[model samples]
Target: MRNPSLAPAPGDAVGALPSHWPRAVAWALVAATLVHAVVFIATVANPLVISDAWYFVDVFLRKYVDGQLTLGDFFAKRSAMDHALPFHKLLLLLNYRLFGVDLSVDAWIGFAFAVATLWLFRVALKRATPARDFADWPVQLAWVAMCAVYVSLNTSEIFEWPLLTLAFVALFCCFALYLAAWRALEGARAWPIVVAVFAVTLVSDGGGVIAVIAAALATGLYGLRTGETKPALRAIGAMVLACIAVKLVSWALAPPMQSIPMAGGPHAAAVSLPRLALAMTVPLSSGVLYPMQAQQVFHSFGHAVDMALRLGFIVAHAVFWWQAWRRRPTAAWFLAVATMLLFYGLCAGVLIGRVPQYGEAAFLQPRYIVFYQLHVVALLLMAVCWYVERRPSLDPANTKRVGGAMIAACLGLVLLQAPLDRQAWIRAPYQQAYVQRLAVQMEALADKPEVAPDKCMPQITVCRMPEPVRVRVVVFLRDHHLNVYSPAFRQRHGFEAD
Candidate 1:
């Protein structure tokens, strides 16, 4: 039976020809993505390496840039205590080496990566959608617009974080798999593309086991739909093998985490589900009301409201997913759901082992989930497109209604979150000033002839300064390792020295 939702084929003049609408939309998407990227770079360039990004940059500068990979620094001395992953550190080091130590250079590198990621998404959409006429224009436009929004909204963390880089790499791998599957189904030799996809997939993330499983399920579903199972099975097997090989190699070459005190395995497993759900809901909500704040009277009401908002967000995501499954049972949509669930599960498991005190634990931070957020957003966009496409006989009035509702919902969310975004931006200059102050102090100490090179480790305390000044001084001293200071010098400066 013919699919009821399929768009009617155009006449002979347009047969097998790419439509002008899709092409125009693609160009506009490219432009929008570029503009958002530019704005992101401009906003984040000088902010103090806050949170995980700072640690990643520190490790990269000390270990990769200094050529001390064997016995190098992780994010911080504290990171060694917590078993920090080296992947982000490595990327930061490469960025520093290629572009120099300037924060501006890092900003530009991030912007470039953001642009590349958008182009990759565009390519993936073109490969995944089956429609060939002007009707496909809306689908293409929606996909690009969603990506643009994600890039703009999450730039505070995702643009500079190595985890986001890993996510992009994973998306590119998925895109490659889509192309390879298409080629294989068409009876073309696609082994090379499969191999390339496998390679990229392996290097993208440590949790790539989850991605590989999702890819396998996607390939299996595609094969079943098309009545060709062997090639898909082979592709899945290849992907699995690639993931295993990468993990083995990483285990061998990277520093062992055994010495670091891991959160108890059982504990880690226990917290997985709740944390995953929390992470998924919190960022999508209108305000940040961390669960830990519920104990405080002032924030208790806000916390309750936040919980309600989270439930609403999850329901929204669920509705979109259901619509996609009903309209299009494509491999991509299925895979997107699988990946989201797997990642969420893994996150829940990991959270159980870590400290559960929400405020003190870094894992509770929403930015940690930025990697999976891309996939979630992609799935939602695909669902929306599928929903629109399924109403093939949709009248102009109904179409307008659906389109208007979608736009209104999105705009409302943006408006509701505008306060948070503004606060983040307003605080950026303060972070920049703090970093600049620390840098100046470090540079001054580094220039002093009396400070020995061996004492330049970050642990030394510069005690002489006032509390605020001392905090920056300590950060500076830790950064440069100026450990030995004369008590006389402290007296001269009207401060205590250690």
Candidate 2:
């Protein structure tokens, strides 16, 4: 039989809330999310090609166009060091086939995936709730807190950059896998869902393998604690076997240049162990700390404050975990812990891989903000669960005060993050200007093949293509009328694509 103490108090149910304040706060979070999305779409949603999209088009798409790469080979081939990115490649191919290579579409698609990730969290939150409904104030509070974290500007790269949608896809699959595992532990037939989601997650990014392993471990622990160990063991075994099978196949297809544990493997990271340890704590602090820039975070904050903040976050995490442990194991508690481990493992993997060479800046990359923000969401949810578990002991007036305080804190977080959001807003115009300049440079370079790479491109732009690939890419754009060369694109932005 399940422990009676594991259940939430009846007063904590949605039907028991006494005021309209929780609903109002929830609406405010939703509005904030919407405003963030609208602001992004309005200001920076252009199709000008840049960054990794350049390589994909110049290599994979070019190969397919030249008849050198078959559809099967295109999907199977790995790129960008160790990434097994067949799924991302598939999306790229579909966009090309459906709508001539358009970066704007890719950008919007990425935004869509980001929105979908938020929706997935809501689904997970629903499942974790004791009443399995958002009818209660605590559930509502947790949902809103997650929304605030999800819309953070720190992770704006995932929202704006077209290719980084791969991260969001991987996150979605990881969360789906956890939900499936939860179901299986409850005697539901969910192993197939787990298997399918795991396969998707495995190819989504290099960190997919680590995420799957973490999920399995968390699921197993939750099962063992709740007396459902057999199902948990089965889920873990399935995930482990799947990971091995996929890793072998991918290696056979194309051996990875370097192991993912550390960029150059264990020996490369051995000397940097102390810094790596400090960098690992970045995930905990990065969620809320908005340092000016990736490289400037340590510089701007100074060593003492940076170290203190990271250590403080560590203590905060420990307190929440202890609260979860003291209570009877609930799915909410387990999943919250699981989400934290899932991202924390990824953060550690990244820091271990890059911190030795790149230093603390590696952890502060804008792209990584997505991982840390989700980590913060998990921490917030853990706090919500703790609050729910304690609600029965508080008198009605005390309950009101605590609930009001929580809502105010969420609002305060939004206020604290406003500067970061404003930064994203201000940067959008500059990015648009840069893209326009890059288009002019590409158009000029296409016309003059002998032109030096350095002359036309900005020092800051990633569009500085090599001499060889540079000529081919511009010529391809010129002849095929893609990107800025597209007649339609030209008409819109004063350059033509066919």
Candidate 3:
């Protein structure tokens, strides 16, 4: 296979065809962008508001009311003490300050990030594989479309809050590095661009490790093409500096990680390899449907069947990995696959004890694998596009057919999962309504003279008591076997009753 760097520019127009193909692609991308933005905003804003939005809103409100904000506020007590990275927290804080602590505002903020992510993906794909054949465009577009739609609809806490932003920044930085490498391959001094890209990738997320590796791989490939290693070494140095800087900055801030109490100890052996593989595969087959209780399709088959399904997922990923590597041995493609494998291994270790079990352990919780899924899918898409672009004899019509099939399959899965997502969202209100109603009831009792205001109210006043509050209060107190004026209520300002 010819190096993509050696291929003629897309604008060369060597083939006898209409001159407007490139322009047409540009227009299609624009339309896709608008449609994607609408879907993103609608999904995030309506009945399906993710629970993380509530947590973030609460954190923002607490800080806004208190006149202070810190990374420690985002995690539970134990997690805060462990001092997790604050990059995402900082972004969320900035958004909260500018837009207020409302779900609608946050949804828009998330939507903007989602759009930027798709844009970066398009730009990266264009630079990474600038195909001249009009047939290759559909494959490239299909990859972008799948990523955009799946990511947006599956919008979990990690994707919506911070990781989505991180993914965009990482992709943008990766493209910048790709451009720099491209320049160097063309005999230009582009070290400055390389350094800038390195810095940006580092500050984005720890996962930028993948970007760094890709850069190193690119440098090596370029060196092989030109028989010089200095450029590769320089790229490596930049990546090292970026990683060091991120670590140093994180250590300096060192926000508390002990805020959130963890359910299990730090034992990594609990994560099984087979389980992890199954968890990872569930997303590809079911999109984000596993999170919805009404849509879970794999639970009742017993442990042995679960293990078999997990093995199947591992086999699928293995095939994907082989196909990508065989299609093209580019540094970016290799790095993407390796990083994904490493990430899968780590996640599996945390759940099922080995790299292969990532699927079973991951299940369908959006929070656990949102970023991971995106990276894997993106890399797979990149590999496919690169392969389609390089094959000289491949028919444009055939490429589109295959690309269309992949896109249709992905969209079909997403559509099938939509109803379950909606049901889950509708159920959310009921899940929390009881607690909200109880709080209202407690407020009423605190205002009643018979309940002893001092004993029930404590320091906080239950101002503006609503009618029928006592009725709710009596029902809850009797049902729960609790005193109307429990001492614990007074101790915690009646808020504890709820």
Candidate 4:
């Protein structure tokens, strides 16, 4: 209950906010979630990227920019993944200059980025909430609960791979850009910010294409609905032209996939619509059941329960989004859902088209889960906003009932996840083992100066992690001055790929 004695007078700073409902319960949930995430990240030990950092520092910026190796030679030879990443390159270069390759520092940087993104998400939710719902603490707590679950599910990709910051940055960029376009429809002057963010996003990753395409689609539709046809048309045209330009430049910088040995093989199957549908329905609290990217997972009653809970979450979430959309029926709501769904729905296609094997195992990958979780969270926020707009409340009984239920549900989901969180941390040993095995050979090579610069550490294998890191690590150490291979010597052999 709001304190009658201390209630803010109308027109006062505090009084400007929804004054009828007490905000203590909602803020508590948000604060607790933030604290939990921070503490967990702080305790993480020796987290390493599956592959990018090693090669990025040792190859892309170091050799490619020095003019010692041609784009085709260095790219075809040293590139870990097929995509050309200006952002990744810049990150590697900046890190090299700022602090060198310190794993502890790098891990924290990623954690900070995630924390920042989470806060940005919180702000977004605040902006989306209708004025009538501003005092609806129950819905606010529910949003916090959903966000906690979203952060918990994608630890593998989010915490481990610093390079994935590109995706994180792009996701936020797209959402904000979509909103800017929406404002343009409403005659707000926010397109410059949209254009700037979008331009940087173009170089982040191939995944960024999902954001741009989705944003464009959402903006174009907004024009039709709002009768801002001319403004929308010009915005769409500018966005499309920018996207094309970025693609052309990125392609020019990117190595040809045909240059890789795998591309010569038989073509893989394209992802189907049904698979995309299944991806969309994954339960919000069902993350523990997924096991993310852990090489070895401990299964128990909780896992089984998680499976069932996810099924329930799927059904509940679908209905929730529909009800929210039905309530609001606004272009903003439509665009938010549409943009996110496009990103989520395209996961299968992007993976299948890039690496058929990845597409086959798309459901199991933690990296993909990040995008999937975003779509679900976006839906929830949009729904809650509309639901509140139509049904804001201030009664003590209403607060007790709605807030109690929402808080219980959110807290219940977190308690159920304790076992999985334990499992996620214990696997740090496996990463240690993986890193140790490779580190030993690296040390050996560093000690033996006589080994051929190109031939040293010829075949590297890391078993404790997933399958992508082998080619990644090998290419990284190939041209570096390890094993006492001098800079001149390493530079001379920059054309070789491990």
Candidate 5:
């Protein structure tokens, strides 16, 4: 079978049609982006009002207000995400200083980070594409459209999550680091920038350190064939050493953590492989373990349509990997390959840490998918780039059909995601209404009642709320010097019957 890369992209006019195809495609991407925004607005809750959000923000502010926060505390304190992400910590500080515990302002701050995170991925994918075909309008359209679909899959869950932000920050920094390496190869001055981004990634999340290792591996592998291995090796050692230094310091400064009984045997890796694969594809089904396992034909058609988009992505990258190795593996190819390896490393780390931590429920939550989904998306984008670079010899006509099919498949998925995103099975379980209601109740509680407070004066618990959201809600109340009717933690200032 002829490789799609060696053929025409469907509807490729060879510039014969005066850009009939490219304009329409570009408009399609624009429409996708708009629709993505609409879906996000309609379905997602207010950013500042979410599980664990107000609680984390309140903890930081409470410490700061009581003069308990120090520079040392900034590095040492673990937030809801369970690590010291200076990026997130710094954002919290900014929100407090500028907004004075205002939720509206804080929400926008979190949203800004979300936008930056997604944009960085878009930029990284575009950079990974070969420069020759990258200029083609068709490729640009394809690029934006695919990215929009992925981002809109769930608006990054559209809430203020400290850990998620940490992950996104690290992912962005990793992409930034990769771009810096790419520029350095092009004879641009980028090492200083690389060093800065590397440090940022390390502190941002545990994943950041892995990303540093991944970027270095990509550059180092490219060096092996190019015979410029010395510089890459030097950079790799410096970054790894730095990453280790920061993490150790963080560990020393932070409180000691209890060790969990690890379930890391050979079976751990075996168990993780399929979970991660299913997790990676969860976004396609708008965040389900298996959206395509539909029973009814009415719903099955949409599943088929959406799964085709994801399958096309998988097939494209698989072919690109097969073909790229047969030819010269460029720096971008190295990046793509290393990123896939990074995903495996991420999966291994997760299963080892989580399985023992949560036991049977470790792999149940689709939320775990967020940590490595970008790696899958990155591979898909890079695969297309690799294909374009390899088959520059082919005319547009020969290349457009396959390319068009992939792009068409992507555009079709965009339409399907809008409805699925709102209707996701996880949506009902993960809704932010309970947290939102709690936010309002807290505001009203700030003022004392003329009469005595009721027994359930601060009944923060909502029966409808799930455990994850309920726990965070209780934390927020306790942190703000309010009474929580729990045996374990009835606050000091709060009035509770002894």
Candidate 6:
């Protein structure tokens, strides 16, 4: 049975495509992907094991390898975040067992998932556009533009980093689960996929909570439309139960967290205002910050123009969401609404989890940019849907004007954003610095169990790791022949092998 949502919209150009058009889209995607890879290699292709990768190897992998942490503990063990990292731990162990701690393997695995996320976004965009006009230049260009920004270097912290790959894992799973639930809402046999994704979501990071809620809401909305409430109710009930279960298990196993009062005081408004402002602006600020971060062409714009651009995007999205909501519910509407939910939900999570410690800066971190990037892409799709729906009826001259303006905006954004993204990868600031420090520490620790007795080795303060812990991990690496101490790693990095 065909889904009502899949039926061609009025004046949709679905069947008007030329035979070669599909190939054009495919080639365009291919080109975008190649550029993504090239930018990754050019910027962040460092193979050195560093930071959280070492932390995981020390805490989780080392314990597991030494028979201290069993498989059961692996599933329940909490990381420094005080949240279960079963999936992340399992992946780290699997990589260790299969290939013996290769950062490239970890990075490439993350890169693959990043590509998969882009592909899923493409699928969603194709479905979400009301006109489904693949033959139209604007629609095709939108896909290409989305592909470019989806892999933007601003998100390298997740896509290019090995230990931090959990972000992409959660991201890809969220996208997959949402799409599968959408299919089920449309009356497809996607329940199994939904179930599988939900199971994975339990072990993932906080983003999984948003994924399940958004999906359940989407399903519940379907029930409202069809007047069939039982299945949706059951699905929502199951999700609630699963969420409770995960939280209970985490609270039981994880250490007690120090509570910070984020509200309910005379100064509450002052404390909360910055966080709220940062959260609201994250969707647009990422692109604005990236160009400025590049320290090249966009550096001239300074703080005032940057703030203006950020606020402008926020207001534009507000109008777009309102317009999307006023329209009848469709797949695109559901996607836009759900994505909006995700955007704010993630921002809320950041507020609660990070704002106390990091302040408003937490919202601006590169790691958080990946989530907002998806929001931006969804908004772009929504904009395309709005324009394409009206294009069929607009005067030719007016259509040309609007189309030309959109094209200019798209190209301008790409041109402004891409260089900074590329520059970030090229700079590869933290990765290069952290690895160099690790190498120096590893070398110093060589021929001894630790660094010189009187000397304190320089530390990467960003990691908040203690010197003793670093010394112990380095000793373990030497003894176990892992990471910098491993012969393979030594050979790869041009260090003399013992």
Candidate whose TM-score is highest: 2
What TM-score do all the candidates reach, one by one? Answer: 0.65, 0.84, 0.59, 0.71, 0.69, 0.82
For model 6, how does the per-residue alpha-carbon lDDT over 1-498 read when each residue is reduced to its tens digit? 543544555666555445566448655655766566665654454455554455566667778878897545544433233445677777777877776676666666666777787677667766766434544556666666666666666555665555555466677777776676666555666455446455546547467777777767766765665555765676666666766676666556654332221111113222568566755575576743543463354566655666776888778778876766444445555666566667777777777767666666667777677677766666766767677666767898998888887767666556655666656666676766656655665566656543353343333221234556656666776787776667877787555555
> Model 3, range 19-110, lDDT digits (tens) per residue?
56544664575466457545544443321112233233334434544667654353322342122324445555564455332223444554
Arranged by TM-score, best first: 2, 6, 4, 5, 1, 3
Off by over 4 Å in 1: 1-33, 46-93, 103-107, 128-141, 159-203, 223-228, 255-280, 283-309, 320-325, 329-335, 338-346, 349-364, 393-397, 407-421, 440-498
What is candidate 4's TM-score against the reference? Answer: 0.71
lDDT of 4 by residue, 80-155 (tens): 3455556555555565455433343454565565566556555555555554354555555655656565666345
Please say which candidate is ahead in lDDT: 4 or 6. 6
Give candidate 3's TM-score.
Answer: 0.59
> Given candidate 3, what's the lDDT at residue 170?
46
lDDT of 2 by residue, 305-383 (tens): 5567678778977887677567555556666777888877877777655665566667767778778877778777777
Rank order (by lDDT, best first)? 2, 6, 4, 5, 1, 3
Each model's Cα RMSD: 8.6, 4.4, 10.1, 8.3, 8.6, 4.9
lDDT (CA) per prediction: 0.47, 0.65, 0.45, 0.51, 0.50, 0.62
Model 6 CA deviation exceeding 4 Å by range: 1-7, 13-26, 36-39, 42-46, 76-81, 128-132, 155-160, 199-203, 218-235, 241-283, 291-296, 425-434, 446-472, 494-498
